[model samples]
Target: MRYAKSADGARIAYSAGGAGEPLLLLAGQGNTHHWWDGVLDDFRAAHRTITLDYRGTGDSDRPDEPYSTEGFAEDAIAVLDDLGVERAHVYGTSMGGRVAQWLAARRPDRVRALVLGCTSPGGPNAVDRGDDVRRSLARPAPEGRRRALLELMYTPGWLATHPGPYRTLGDPTMTPKERLRHLVASERHDAWDALPGIQAPTLVVHGDDDLLNPTANAALLAERVPGARLCLIPGARHAYFEESRSVAGPLVLDFLREHERA
Candidate 1:
């Protein structure tokens, strides 16, 4: 993994592969570049895909500073600037989608097209997982925690066939303090007012059954972002970008290509 220095001199770790136009992939809360491993080749075939670990995750530095979606966007900007890429398509999932909102809104010229998957806009208008879902996610048992997440993230059949533990949730290596910081940063995101200012063509994709992020937020985001299209994958959940990749992936690719510069 190569490194880029953020505005604060934090070492942001990123990896790039494939060929063609640049495509930046951002991971969910507390996750690293490893989360995108499942769909890298598909994206690589069309664009030079780049993935990065958020400041406190993977190979990136863990500066003793508070985190915010805005700061994370800057980290992304640092990566693109470090590589001398003026603009590119961007795809973000979960919290990554939150970061993408700030990136697209705050740095419109650096974004060609955008995709937000299984994510929320945060703030007062965004939907929440409710108390029960929150309770399940807060299970104290490690095994129970993993099982609870797997159940919520994928359909029953998908989990049935894939009978093993996966690290699709938070970064296991992160300390409780680091994870809490990420959760706080994501919770504090408020992009509702900023969405209207985004100039890049946008596509908002989500699973109809995403209780964690609540599928309803997809409509809110699509409605708030001018001309943004929404695609809801039936029978999918929070990790739909991976569980329903065959459907969501091509839709996103088509959207990006539709708006590509000649």
Candidate 2:
């Protein structure tokens, strides 16, 4: 575990590994750096990956205040500064994608490229999660909440073949207070007015069957961001990376490579 001080003097935790061009991985709401474990091995083969626990999650210090996506972007920038990375290929999922977009917009000099997955541009078309899903989030993490959440994230075939890192989800170490903070952070995220400013070469990936953010959100992002391309993976859900790595990972790698060569 490594640490960086945000502009506001808040300490954040991050993990760095792999060898090649730097690629920062930002996990979604309610997720920690451990969320990238499934794809890190493959991603690391091509690029150095930096994963972090945002403020109020994982090993990071939690401040008593409402979380904002913009603030999270600042946390990311602080991480980059701490590591002395002048620029990096940025990739984010769900809320992390929103952060990546904000980072690209706010600090274009620090981003080489941007990859957004299972996220939205945060507007009228963005809040597509249904009442049931919202209710699930509001309630405390139940005994089977991990499995239930995974079910909502991945398709049936992927869930059947790979049950996923159940230990990571079911870990008893995560307290209810921590989980609540994550839930609040996720619920409070709104970045609709911030999309038009992202200038990085962008790739938007969304699952055709995603219920959380929906495919329209991806469309909105691609339509709003200049030169952003959208790819739809079939038979996948919110957790496209975990559910369809064979398809998603290669597509992301190809996009990064193409941008790198451009």
Candidate 3:
């Protein structure tokens, strides 16, 4: 993993490999770049894939102070700049998608396209998560967290049948304070007004069975973002990008390839 120095001089850890157009994977809250391990090779086959750990996750530096989604976006852009990439096709999931909205909205020239999965626009349009999800958001028990998260992330039938898809719920890397701070940033994120200004072609993907953010949020992204397309996977849930990689990987690759730089 390589590290980039953010504008604030925080060391942002990231890993990038492969060829073709660059594709940045901004992971969800409380996750590291390793979160994309399930489908990294598949992406590498066609594009240069770069995934980074947010400020407090994985090998990245964990600053003690609070951070907002906008600040996180700056860190994301810093990763791109450190790599000398002028623009990229970005894919963000959950809170990462929320960060992507701010990045694409605020820095149109740096984004060629966007894929927002299992995320929301925030404000009144944002759907409140269920009790079980709210309880486990960032403060998760390593042993049961994967199982618990899977229950909320994938459909019951899929969970019963599949084994490898829901194994990792992230390493317990963040401290209690870091976890709560991340949640607070997530709660305060409001991209409802900023999305319409995004200049890149966008795709909003979600699982019909998603409960945490709800599939309704995906619809909001599609409706609000100009020229954005929406794809809702049947029988999938919040972790569709990982749990349903076969479906989502190809769809996202197709979308990015369609809009790849000339």
Candidate 4:
């Protein structure tokens, strides 16, 4: 892992691997740079993939305040700038997608193409997570709470078929405060008014059964962004890339290649 310093002097942790066009990956809320491990090799085969832990997650710093999508976007730009990467394709999942939207709109020159997976543009137009899902996030017991959260992310069929992912996923390294900060940041995310202004080619991908963010959010995102394409994986859940990367990975690669530059 390598380190980059944000404008605020925060130590942003990032890892770069693979070879080809640069692809910057922004992970979900409380997710570290390794969040894309499942599909890293696939991406590396075609692009130089860079992943980073959001401030307050993994090896990154935790400021004593709430986080914001705009703040995280700046953090991302900081990492890229630190690496001397002028522009690259960006892929964001879940809360990271919110950050990506803000980045593409606020700093269009830093982005080449965009991929938003299982996320929403916050505001009154967005649908909130269900009560059951919210309850699943509460911590009565750490293990049980994690299991509940996993249930919400993947379908029962998927769980039955893939019984070992939790072992590989382990647990998030975020503290309770960091989790709350991330949740607040995600809730406050509002990019609906800015989507139309994003000049990068965009792809919106989501599972058909994402209870946390919902598939409808994907449709709304794709519609709001000019010329954006939507790809809905049938019968998939919120963690589509982890649960079904065999399908989503190829689609993502194809999209990046379709817009790949010489």
Which candidate tops lDDT?
A: 1
Give per-residue CA lDDT, model 2, range 1-63, as digits (tens).
999999888999998998888899998876788878878898899988899988877787788
Candidate 2 local accuracy as lDDT? 0.81
lDDT of each: 0.92, 0.81, 0.87, 0.87
lDDT of 4 at 218: 94
What tens digits encode model 3's per-residue C-alpha lDDT throughout 1-262?
8999999999999999999999999887887877788789999999989999899888999998998899999999999999999999989999999999999999999999999999999888777777877677445566565566767877777777877643346547788788877888888999988988998999999999888788888888999999999999987888898778989999999999899777
Q: How do all models score by TM-score?
A: 0.98, 0.91, 0.93, 0.95
Off by over 4 Å in 2: 135-141, 167-174
- Candidate 4's displacement at residue 260, Å, is 1.3
If candidate 4 were superposed on the true structure by all CA atoms, what would the RMSD be?
A: 1.7
Screening candidate 3 with a backbone cut-off below 3 angstroms (N, C-alpha, C), the clashing residue pairs are none
Query: Residue 224, candidate 3: how far off, in angstroms?
Result: 0.7
lDDT (tens digit, per residue) of candidate 1 on 172-240: 989989999999999999999999998888999999988989999999999999999999999999889
Clashes of 4: 0
lDDT string for model 4 (97-214, tens) is: 9999998999999899999999998999898888888787776897887787787688898888877645223226777788889878989999999999999999999999889788
Q: Residue 110 deviation, candidate 1, in Å?
A: 0.3
Residue 233, model 3, lDDT: 94
Q: What TM-score does model 1 achieve against the real structure?
A: 0.98
The prediction achieving the highest TM-score against the true structure is 1
